[model samples]
Target: MAKLYTQESPKQKNLQPKKESIDFILNYSKALSVINCKDKKFELLLN
Candidate 1:
């Protein structure tokens, strides 16, 4: 079981996120928050 576990570890290492994807996700989250704030303000104005 120890030998099998050692072999599987390398596959897990490959699953790490690439820099570009990480950047994209962060930017996307920021953009989403901005949009949500605008939407809330618009709602308030309407009411």
Candidate 2:
């Protein structure tokens, strides 16, 4: 079991960066959605 765990540890570590990128993409989409909402509101005010 110890040997298995040692081998898997590097795989788990490699996944950390992928997780971070996913989180960043999620946050970026959220920001874009908020910006779109604000733009719509501004357009309504202009009209």
lDDT computed for candidate 2: 0.52
lDDT of 1 by residue, 1-47 (tens): 45554444445545778899999888766555322564473222211
lDDT of 1: 0.56
User: Residue 32 in candidate 2 has what lDDT?
Assistant: 55
Number of residue pairs clashing in candidate 2, backbone atoms closer than 3 angstroms, sequence gap of 3 or more or interchain: 0
Estimate, for each residue in 1-47, the C-alpha lDDT of model 2 and write its tens digit.
Answer: 45553444434544445778998777776555322564473222211
- What is candidate 2's CA lDDT for residue 35? 25
Error of model 2, residue 44, in angstroms: 16
